[model samples]
Structure formats: structure tokens, C-alpha cells
Target: MSTPGEKPDTRELVEADVVPRSRWRMQLVWLVPIVALLVGGWLATKAVLERGEKITISFKTGEGLEAGKTKLKFKDVDIGVVEAVTLSTDRKHVVAKAEVVRDVANLLVDNTRFWVVRPRISGGTVSGLGTLLSGSYIDVDVGNAVKPRTDFVGLEVPPVFASDIPGREFTLKSAGLGSLDVGSPVFFRRLQVGQIASYQLDPDGKGVTLKVFVNAPYDRFVKGDTRFWHASGVDMAFDTNGLRVETQSIVSIIIGGVAFESPADSIEQVAAAANAQFELYATRADAMKQHDRIVDKYVVNFIDSVRGLTVGAPVDFRGVVIGEVTQIYTRFDPEHRRFSIPVEIQIYPERFTSRYQTGRAGGRISDDPKGIANYLVENGFRFQLRSGNPLTGQLYLAMDYFPDAPKAKIDWSRSPPELPAVPRTLQSLQDSVTRLLTKLNNIPFEAIGNDARTTLRTTNSMLSKLDADVIPRAHDTLASAQTALDSANSALQPESSLQQTTEETLRELARTSAALRTLADYLSQHPEALVRGKSGGQP
Candidate 1:
């Protein structure tokens, strides 16, 4: 320091004390760098915290999906965005990568549904129209499952009902899936109260099973004895009541639907539980038929033709259906060497008779089917076939009293207990015609014609005799009678005995001659009167 220039000798003498700065303190220039480092670190941490969960959804096709434009929505609210769309390794599906808000991470469960919401029409429903204007989006239906899932298979078709809808699910087993499909309406009293949720063929492939949802208040109407039927198209039926056309609504007719009703007697029954199973009948009449517990089977052998009578033909008692034909077959009798049609019918006694009789002790036709059957059979109760519909030529079996029918007895030992059956009306008419023809055939017409000819010849001979001999004689007698009348006129005198006698004699002779002429004329005209006595009339 002393070796510096003379100017430095003056500056250097003032030896400034260099202070040691604290390690924790920073210089003003270092403050800017430190703040920048802290700011950068905070920004990195915030980026990590806001990031959401990543999910991948697989779809059959990516029709409306976009990498960055499509958004994920639940209940019409945006919850995520699609990041990318790519084909699967197998190229059979379109895989979409998405980032959903962390709040919904737990909701991504196994049953959670994902589908592209686009304008669509299915099962007579128009949906996703709003998505058309807003662009297509990924719709989600959160499931009620606890199992978490990140990978999902998207539905090509959207669900008919959301999981949050207020309803109860039920199952129906049908021999076939008529016109029903997802979104098909279900009606109660012609009011739409539910829809078909889904359907699938049964495991055995013999039938189809449908899952239906009935919303809140209408669900309460389903009872233990509730019946369901196919109410899709116009249900037309022809029975004793004549033509009946039944339908639920125009919407149902178009898309197809189901209808249900609880029997009046089942109103007091408990409501059916969720997922309750029921049998779907083909028609309302079949579904509403009262279930019979007591059935008695009897066979009827008919010698007449059984045309127009089918197995399902109704067995009627006084205009009421009490049974049905179950089987019809030809039976050969070994001893009689003839074929007879045997008809098996199942009768429900409860349809006609009360369990307990009223008014009198023996009025009830119950508790003893065999005895009652025997009693009825002995007292003119008979079965007859009658035309049910003249237009269709359908015949049904009828049971009624026929007091004038010939006596018949039932052989109780016979299997199925044969019930006496009379011929149908047409068959009876045919029998009567055949009997009349047979009687006409037995008449001796040729012999009667010969006898009539013989009688005619005899009468002709008598008339010829009268015309040839008696007529001329009657003319001569009439001439004599005229001469006698002239002579009597000449001999007549007042109170002379000879004159009086001659006048009386002439009067008697004139009467005899007139009688002879009248007899001759009668025999000439009425020739047949000679063979038999004349009737009380002029010839």
C-alpha cells in the first residue's frame, strides 16, 4: 500500500474495515434469483396438485369422439375431457383417453356406463338432440358398485333408463319377445308408467326374459296376482263375446309395449318386490282367466262327425265356459268293429258350482264330482256340440239337460269315465234325413200303382155300361113318363074315384121315371163312385 503513487498514499491511509456478512442474509442482487427459484418450485407443486385421474374408455366405434373437443358429462354436466382417441391393438375398438376431475375418481366403478351422446332414435324414442347442437359428448352413468375401474367398455346404444331414475325393476318370462324392445312403454290402465329396460334370450333359448322398470307410484300397483300381457299391437280376439279389439295407446302400437293389471280379487294382496318374476301372457284374456284348482277330466265318444271342433274349443254350460277340449282321437272298438271319436275334456267345477250350497240341502253340485256326474247323467244331462261362430264355422261343446233324450247309463269302471254325447245339430239333421230316405225306400210304390190302375179300369167299365145300356133305357123311361103326365092331365076330374086313382098312378109313374134318369146320369159322370162310396159333394 505504501508503494502506491503519492495519490494512493492519501487514499490508502484510510484503512476501511471490511465487515463479514451473515450467511443467512442475502445481497440485493441475490434476492431476485432466490424469488425466481421459489416461484418456479411453487408453480411446479400447483401443477401436480390440480392434475386429475386418467381413464380409458373403449368403444365399438369412434363416431363422434374427438381428441380435444369432446367432453365427458354426467347428468348433462361436464366432468372431464377426452385427451386422445386411438385404435386398439387389435383394431377392433376405438380407445379414448380421458382425464376426469378427482372428485369423480371413486365413482368410476365396474358398472359405470360410458357412451357417446349423439342424436339417436330407438324404440320410438328421440334422444340426444341437445348434443347435436352442442357437439357430441361422452355421457356417463355412475353405477352403484364399490369396485373401482379405470378401463371401461362403452355402450354403442345408450341405456333406456338412468340408474338414478325412481323405479323398481321386475323380470318377465315370455315364450317369445313379441314386439317389445328397450324403451318400449309399459302401461297401467292405459297410462304409461314404465319402460322396458333390457331383454335377452333365456339360457335354454326356449323363451325370452325382460327387465322392466315401473316408476314410483305405479310400482305400487303390482301385486302378487298381477298379470302382464303383450299390449303392443291391436289385440283382436273372437270369442263368445264377439270381436274384441284391445290396445294400450298409439305409442304402444308403434314401438311395442307391455301392459299389466291386478285382478280384483288380488287387490288385497301384497305388492310385488323389486326384481319380482312374472309370466308374460300372449293376450289379456289368457292373463286374466281365473286359475282353477279343481279339474275333472271326462271322455266323450261320438259316433257322429267331429268337424269344426278343435282341441281348445270351449265347453259351455248354459252359455258359461266351464271346460275345454283337451284331446281328440279316433278309437276302435274290438267287439263292435267300428271307429268312434273320443274327445277328452277338462272341466272346472268351480266355474259352475258353489262349494257350499244355499237354500236347500241337495241344491249344491259339489264335493262329489263322480256322484254328481252320475246323477246328472241319469237325469238327462247330456253333451252336445253346437256352432260357436257361424262366420268361422267354429264349434264348441255344450252341456245341458235333455229330458226327452233316450235313457243311457255311464259305466263307472271305464277309464276317464265316459260321458254320453249326442250328435251335433247338423249331424242330427243328417241322421233325420237318412232315416226319412230309408223309410221312403221301404214303401211299395210299384204295387200301389198297379192297384190304382186296376181300380181305374173297373170304374171305367162301370161308366161304359151306364153310357151304353142304362142311358138309352133312361131316355125311353123319360118318354113314357112324359106320355103318362099328358094322359094324367086329360083324366083329371073333381072328386071322381077312377079319375083320382088314374091321376095318382100317373104322378107316381112320373116320379119313378125321373129317379131312373137321375141314377143313369150319376153313374155316367161319377165312375169312381161305383168302386167306393161317394163323398158329400156334387159330381
Candidate 2:
């Protein structure tokens, strides 16, 4: 230090004033920490403000949930991660906690649906199979509602993507639940364009209600008169037309399905509104039966027994079913003084027309029963019970023109027009058989048996008498006659003496006759003398 001070001695002597040169430096050191603190605060604030919103979803199962591993995807684009997996309070479901990026926050809504994506095979569809190897994941479907939401109830099954698709919802009512299931295809003219969304049984247990979805282009096929039928499984039928096997599709055959068709004229009509209620027919035959309309109600009284008749039996015209029996009852007729079975039937005039009476869809027959009855009776129209199923003894009402049958009188003064009936052909045959059986029962079987027994005994006695004496006596008589004939032949031979004597006796008889004739002539001359002994030696 002393050596360096030679130059510094003068410099230090000048600065020896000890001017307290600001013990604090340029203050940049303090500024450094302040800037760092401010920057840290700003970074912290940014982190806090930019954080994504947290969401909770309830799922029936946590099958695909993995803490920090399960990613939520929208259309295969990852948008969130499952942060926590826990059970609901009731333990009926799993609650998955997730953080969704702010970028997609608008997608959350009240109606938004979520489901686990895994390998599935249903209704001829194989979905999410790639997830088998990649592992399962949560799939998110955004809703269109403007209201934002964070809590969600997950779906047990994947929902149809209605946002990207245009379609409609419709309701179907059915009397029975057939092969149709959720995801079962709905067909339009054999083209699959929809599916069954849900089903519910009526509270009364009389029918099943189904909710179905139809895609855009195919939904236009549904109309006011459209017919929906269960096309699932195989349809086998044998009829006058012959055996028929009907199926909508191979998928339908495997998984079950529904099909719909509109009337030809309805093709140009307006499409049914969303959630339009329609009937689901059990079979195509039932759908085509067009049983919706009612035109006439009539009472047909049968003269013969209605043993095989039942409600819902077809009332046919010729071979075509035009109506059905609705009710059967019997009430004593105060005027006619008899209790008769009243078969109440409903007839559809549209059934007789070549095409359905869609123009008359809401129309009904005139209420003038007297006029209608008179017209029908004048036209020789009659109702009769006919055997529909011979093996089952099922009978149905048949309306036909029986020109030669006795005229049927209709009593139109009654509440429901009464239609007189002719005996069924089968009933007539049964009556004939009954009469024959009655006659057979009345036959004198005991008297016939007694007579037959007496005849048999007499015949047996005669046979015994013949065997004991008649045959032997007859044989002896025949032998004696043969012996006498042999003796006569021997006596009358050409060279025998009896033959020569017979010739001489014949000549003597001729001579005696001649002498008797001459004596009779002489006796006639002397009347009294020849009264006795006219011929010689005659007296």
C-alpha cells in the first residue's frame, strides 16, 4: 500500500476531505429487487386469471376415468383432463372432477351430454373399437343452449350427435314390446335412417310407448297416415297367396328394427312435426289393416249357435275382411219376446274401396238406419257365421249376397240397427246331423233285435229238422222213383211183351169207342133204353 501511494498520495491528499461519497450506491441494486418483485406479481396474477374453469360430471361408472390420465375429447380433439375420480354420496354413480380449457368454455351447457368412449358392439354397429388398444376415454358432446353450465349428469350410453345432424323426434305407440331395443334401426322403405331412442310401458300396462329419431331426408317420409311396423326378426306366413318370408334388412334380422311407410297420396303432404304420435304395429299385416276408422255399427243376430265366434273376428265381404266384431251380448227383446245374442260389429267402408278412403278419412255413414237397412235387405245382403279356422273352430261374420236365401228383415227401430242372419253352412250341416242323430235315437232298436233273434231261431230249427229227416226221406223217395222209372223203361222197351200188349190195348180201346158211339146213337133214338149201359158191357 505504501508503494502504490506514491501516485495516490497526491490524489488521496486532494480527496482527503472525506466527502462522505454517498455510502448508498446508484440505487440500481434496490431497483433490481423491486423490478423482480413486480414481475413475479404480474406473472402470478396472469397465472391466476388465465386458469381454466373446473367442472364436475356424474357418471354411472368410472370405467374410463384415470386421475390425470383420462383426457376429455370433443370430436377427437383433447380439451380437458380428468383431475379426480370419486363416488357420489349415494354411491349410485361416480363423480369425475375435470378442468376444461377456457377456450372451450362456451361448450358447457345445461343439455350438454358426456359419455365414456370404449369398444361397443350394438345394433349392428361397432363403435370406439380403436379405444380398445388406446384405452377408454371420456367423450364430450356440446349442447346448443345459450345458458352456460359446469355441473353435468353423464349418460349411460352415447347420445346421437344431433348438433351436426338435422333430424326430428317422433313418438310410437305399440300394443306389445317386440324385438325393438334402443339403437334398433328405423327404416324407410328398407333404408336405415333412424333408431329407437327410448321405450316406456304405459302405466296401465296396456301398451308401450317408443321415442324414435329420424334423420333429415328420411324424416320427410313420415306423414299423417304413415304406418310404422316392427320389421325386426323374420316374418313367415302361409296364405292363399302362398308362403312368404319378409325381412327389412340383415341388420334388422340380427338386431331387430322398425320400418315406416306413408300412403301413396301422402307422399306429397307435409311431414309430421317433431314428436308426432303414431302407432307401432306388431306386424306389417296389422299395419296394412288400416283399423283406424269407424263407419258403421250393426247388430247381427244369429239363428244358429255362435259357439266359435269371438270378439275381433273378421267380418268379411267375400274373402276380404271389411269389419270386426266388437261386442257380444244378449237382451230379451220386449217386442219379439226372445233373448237373442247381439253380435255388435264395426264396419269400415274404406276397406271395400280399392284404395283407402283417405278423402273420407273422417267421414261416417249416414245415421238413417232404416234407409240403410232397407237398402241392404233389398240388395239381398245377409250376415252369416262362417268357419274361418276349421282346425281351431274359429268363426267370423260374413256379409255376402245370397240371392236365393230367405229375405232377412231388419229392425231399425232399435238403438243399433239389427241385421237378420241366415244359418251358416256349417251350422246347417250341424242341424242336419242333429236331426239325423235324433231320428237314429228314436229308431226301434229293441224290436228289431227281438225280430232278428226270432228269425235266427226259426232258421236254426228248420236247418236241424232238414238235417235230421228231410234230406234222408227225400233221398229215399228219389231212389224209389228212380227204381220205378227203371222198371217202366224195362217194361216199355221196343222188344218187350208190355210194349206189344200196349199196342193191342190201344187198338181194342179204339174199337170199343167206335162200338160205344154206335150204341149211344141207337140210345138217342130210343131215349129211355140207353140212360144206363149204352155201350156193350158198360152197365
Candidate 3:
């Protein structure tokens, strides 16, 4: 310490040795702080190097999410944690910041999927039950894509399948979603083969496109010609073939599902490529029907009632279905003041060709369909509306030979060439009755009745005269006959007087004969007395 006024010792102090202050000496007090600072810096560097990827996930809502508490998991293994949760600039979504472990940082790719795990039910599935006890976490699905991404959109629902599951995804286009939803099961031959991965409405809003995954060996059965249909609820049909009930399973009945199968006749069993697009039919019958490439349209005009006919009604040729009714409309002829029913039918010519094996190969009908039709019409081929279901009053168009049908000409100039039509059998019978009644109505019934009444009166008068004149004469004749019979009976009696008189006369004659015999004997004795013998004998 230098005194305030003592300057005389300064010359002697530096003369003994010239000493230099150490350039880099750390003070003891600062030693602890330096060491601590070094350690803190090392830790910060290590954290920067060993820390997982920092990612932000956008969610619709902050439901089932928490900052610093919710973990990020892959296959139920903790790989990261949610560090912060904040709202987006537009306030439309909740953005979660997460730190993934360095070990799995490579898995944060553009295709990696993230979703909040929560207890929920969808499409007949109960998932995330463990989350109820353990709290919600961010679920991650690792992606194979090499492109790294930090910003992501979280899914609202769990994925239908895991990335590691061996399967092929397919796209199905349908008129509507029906009962199908994400996670809805997909069936192959009623076997649970896959589930619906996702669905989106078509751009034009005309239909929906669904993505489905068929697992492993079942995926091998997905052929190019495989048909898909909605197998939801019960498929009950009552038709010409009779009642048919079809279903996949009880699960399908409750939550709806999709089913696929190749036609039994199909030979193309090659596995379909991934994401193959296919049409989704409403029912199995529709899906299984053979596609017809050849179509022929015609119009049939009927003068009779088409009460039970409808669109899609079968157009039958004999017992075979050749076509279907497309449309039915009424036409009025102003000049004739008459109405006619015109039915538009779409015929599958290939159906006829294939069934009958006609014309040429490859199911080709005759080159001249018009000429053939005209010839058939000339040969009495006509269309008639016939009842298909009596109870339901459903009608179908029948094409058959009607040799007795009235001759008619086909007007080929119409948009759809007109085909000849005959009245249904019932209608024809009604017409016959109407004509018979008309003929009976023409008879002169009043004149006939008057003539018959006059004849009856004349006959009755004649009969009355006969009865009054003939009855008295007939009774008198009968009485006379009876009297004659009584007189004859009395004459035959033994006690009558005439009978006694006759007996006495006969006795006198007998006495005279005896006297004559005695006189003859005396005459024999005396010849002279012969003449007077009889007198003497008498005397």
C-alpha cells in the first residue's frame, strides 16, 4: 500500500528485479464459473447434436393433446415428445412442436404420418383403448420416402393399416359411399381380407373414390377382372329366379363393407397392380353380370294398356332375356285423335348372339340388323307386354312369333326404328268379347219376342177348344162300353128263363123220335100197314 504522500520508495522498488505479470492467469473466484460455463456449453452442444428432429404438426383442434406431456410414438415406442402447442397464424389449426429422438430422425419423411391416439370407435373398430388410461399421444407411421419434412398435417382418425402390413392398395369408384367408411372391412369370398383405407368425393361430386388394402395372399386374388360391390346390410331380391338373400357377415351388416370376386368364368387371375381403379357396383348381381358390348335400340308401339310395364323390365325373346325396357312414353296423333304407347327398349345383341351362337365368331350379330328385324316382323315376330309377376302386376316385354297377328308396317324413319307390337292376350280376349257383344247388340230382340208371344196365344186357344169339345164325348163312350160289358155277363148266368124253355122243347122232340121207331117195327111185320103205320103208331 502506498502512502498518500510517500513517493521516495519508487526508485528503489524496480531496481532489484523486473517482474512481468502473467498474461493468462485465471482468478480463483472465476475458476468455478468458467468450469460451469464450459460444462453448460458442452451440454448445449450435445443437446443440439443428440436432439431429435424438431417437427411441427398441424391439427384441426387441440383435443387429446398437451405440451411437454404428450409423447410421440412409433409402434407404441416413445421416440419423441410434444414440446409446445400453439395456434396457427390463421387460428384455423393447433400447431404442435415436437422433438423426435436422434435415432429415428431419418423416419421424418414427407410421407410420414402423424395422428393423435384417442379412444374412439369407427367402422366397427374399437381402437386406442390404451389411451384411456395412459393419456393421448402423437402416433407416427414411418415412411419409406427419402424426402425429409418438418411440417406435417396430423390425421383426425387412425390409419386403416400399418405401413409394414403386406398388402396392396386399390381404388374403387362408386356412385355413392353407401354404408362404406374408412376402416370398413373388405371381403374376398366372405373372408375378411382387408379394410378401407380412405375415401374422397370425386372432383365433380358425381361419386366417391375409396382406397382399400387387401392383405398378403388374399391380395394375390385381386385380378384385373375382379368385381367389387357394396356388401352392406342385407341383399334381398325377389325376381324371376326367386328370392335371394346374400351377406358377408354380421359385422358388415352393422358397419357396411365392400366385397370383391372374379366371375366364375373369368380366366384372368393375374394379380392386379397396386392402386388399380375399379368400379363399385351396388349389388353382387350387378357386379357379376357379363358386360354387353353390343346394344340395339328400338321403339315398340302398343295400342293396349301397359299398366304393369316399367323401365328395366326384361325384353324377353322366348324364355331368354334379350334386352330391357329403357323408356316408355305416350304419343298422340293429332289428325287421328288417337294415343299410342311407345316403349323404348335396349337390346343386347351380343346376348342373343352368344346365347344362340348365331352369325359369326366373337359374338357378332348379323351385319344387317335392320333387314333381319324387318324379316322377323314380316314373319310374325312381334313385341307384346306380358305380366311377369301377377301379384306385383309387373310387366315385361315379350318378343315372339304371333302368326295370327294383324299385318303391320314398321316405320324405319323414326329416331329408333319402330317394331311391331300386338295386344297382350288378355287385351285380345277382351276385344273378341267386345266384337261378339257388338254383334249381339245388332239382333232385333223386340220383334222376335212379339212374334213368339203371338204364336203362344194361338196354340193356347186351340188347346182350350179341344179340351171343352172332346172331354164330354170321351166320357159318354166310356159309359156305353161299361153297360155292354154288364149285359154280356148276365146272359152267361145258368138261372135265366130262356135257358129253361129251350130245355123243355128238346125233351118233346126226344119223345116223338121214340114213337116213330116203334111204328117202323110194326110196319116190318105187315107191309100193307106201311103207309098207315106211322099214323096208327101215332094214334
Clashing pairs in 2: none
- Runs in model 3 deviating more than 4 A are 1-38, 354-362, 470-539
Worst 10 residues of 2 by lDDT: 357-366
lDDT accuracy of residue 176 in candidate 2: 83
Candidate number with greatest TM-score: 3
For 52-153, candidate 2 gives per-residue lDDT tens digits of 889999988888789899989998999999999999899999999999888898899878888889888765677899888888888888878989999999
| C-alpha RMSD of candidate 2 | 12.2
TM-score per candidate, chains pooled: 0.78, 0.70, 0.80
Return the candidate ranking by TM-score, descending. 3, 1, 2
Q: Candidate 1 lDDT, tens digit per residue, 254-304?
A: 888999998766645678999999999999888998777767788998998
- Write one digit per residue (lDDT tens) for candidate 3, span 1-539: 66789766665565557789897987799989989999999999998889788999999999988998999999889999999999999999999999999999889998999999999889999998998899999999988899999999999988998888898999999999999889999998889999999999999999999999999989999999999999999999765454689999999999999999999888895899999999999999889877777777899988999987878788999998888889999999899999999999988878766543565654556777777778888989899988887766778999999999888777889888888898899999999999999999999999999999999999999889879997788889989999999886776566776667777888999999998997787677667764644444444
Question: What lDDT is obtained when candidate 2 is compared to the true structure?
Answer: 0.83
